[model samples]
Target: MDTTETLQGILEFIDEHITDNISPEVLAAQAGYSTWHFCRLFQWGTGYSVMAYVRNRRLAFAAYELSSGKRILDISMDYGFGTHSGFSKAFRRYFGCSPGTYRLHAHSNRPFPPSLPGAYKYLIGGIIMEPKFVTLPAIKLAGFAIKTTSVAGENSKAIPAFWNDYMSNGMMEKLHAEKFIKKHDEYGVCFQEDMTTGEFEYVIGVERKDDAEISGEYHVCEVPPATYAVFSSPPSDGANFAAAIQGTWNYIFNEWFPKSGYEYAPNCNDFELYDDRSMPDEGKICDIYIPVVRMQK
Candidate 1:
């Protein structure tokens, strides 16, 4: 059989035996190739090591099973995680939330088997745009903060709601009215507080002077100086602006980071800057800044 057909057959085999122990050696035997040769071929065609693809598939199935309301511990063991803690860790890393949180907030469908060759490109979005690199000075921001987790995309829902509340409930005006405010431009900053839990603090605020006075009611955060890769969301109107921005974020994490030759800088902040271009009209746009360092060879 040809490469495509061989890969498809292996995919089917994996689905059939997902909960069973799967290894590259076994799959290599099934594909009639040496283990090393099979592994290289698999990664080249799928953009994932054989085990990573298998683990992701298993996690996808585990996510779908969450909807059944089974006990998390039992389900974890059923999926070969061996323990609740192990399962939770893997689940949080892969799906961006704990299995329990995912159960409450999201329902996952059975993962579709990817077509061979270039399949990973379509996993998130097909388009990847070039980003402009910049070095930014330290920034001081004073604003409201909400604790949120990336679990089950909770951040995705909470942030928008937070913005709506901020904009509509006079918080936006109140902050803009502050004498300490340096500019009308707003920033949505995400600070990773607990990587183990995928929890972070998200701040919605305007930049302030370094020496500006701050109030007790407003939370203050200072972003350290760092080099950033800035990405502009595709031009979009008011109606689809949120989706466009979310899409760009998905592209950055899923598509760009893997190929960018850079990784997220340690203990740094990533943020979205909203300026006049973000006005609720045609051609609305915003910039996303991610602190980055060159990947070690």
Candidate 2:
């Protein structure tokens, strides 16, 4: 089978076994690819990591069952949720409300977006731009760091709240007063602690002077010299900046990286740059930097 066929098979498997503990190894084997290759293909094809796809589907199913008059706790347990609170939190993130509220207004909106059969359709149909490549020198960054995981869609929720807290806490002025900041732009840098576990440390801060004093409450880290593929979003529309950033990332991973002739550089930093030019409500015009190396032929 070709790539499309393989992906369709995997999707079918997930649909048939929605409640099963579908591990990556099992899915990769069914698709006839190694774990690494399967993950890339699955992510590019579905616009979601394997685990994310499963969780979203399960929640969607729960949404369907909620309107059927089933008890919330029973529905949650049916979908492998160990606790009603856990299920409620996950459901809220997916549907923008608690299960109880969603059931009351069942006609409000579709529980989930349509899952594409394969990546090629959306990737080719979207206007994904070619990124500019730049070699950046080592730079120092200062900000608060939080540990988050990509597993079970946690990072999607945690990272945005991290930025909101950083800005609301007046971190920008504090960094600027120390003269540690450069160009008045903030940076959100992702440091991978363990790729295998999808856990990373995210620092929300500004570029700091090389000799800036470290704070006990905050963090200081150096971004080493590397070649980066830089992607820029269209000018901010003064509304919903987070969603726009999320869209840009979906295009990058699903559409760009697979075709760009480069793979992510191992053990390096990936970051987003935002500046004063950005609107508080809408979000700043942003540039995303991903360290990369030439794809081995």
**Candidate 1 lDDT tens digits, 17-105:** 99998988889789766554455456445545577678778899999999998999999998888999999999999988999899999
lDDT of 2 by residue, 1-297 (tens): 445666777877877887788877889788655555566557656646677777877888888888777899999999988899999999998888999998897733334345454543332225657889999998688778899876666777898888777668886567667655665677888775443456678888778766656667668887888899998765546564655676677677666765676777766778898766565554356788988888666
lDDT of candidate model 2 versus the reference: 0.73
Question: What is the lDDT, from 0 to 100, of the residue 29 in candidate 2?
Answer: 81
* Index of the highest-lDDT prediction: 1
Q: Per-prediction TM-score, please?
A: 0.62, 0.63
Cα lDDT, model 2, residue 192: 55
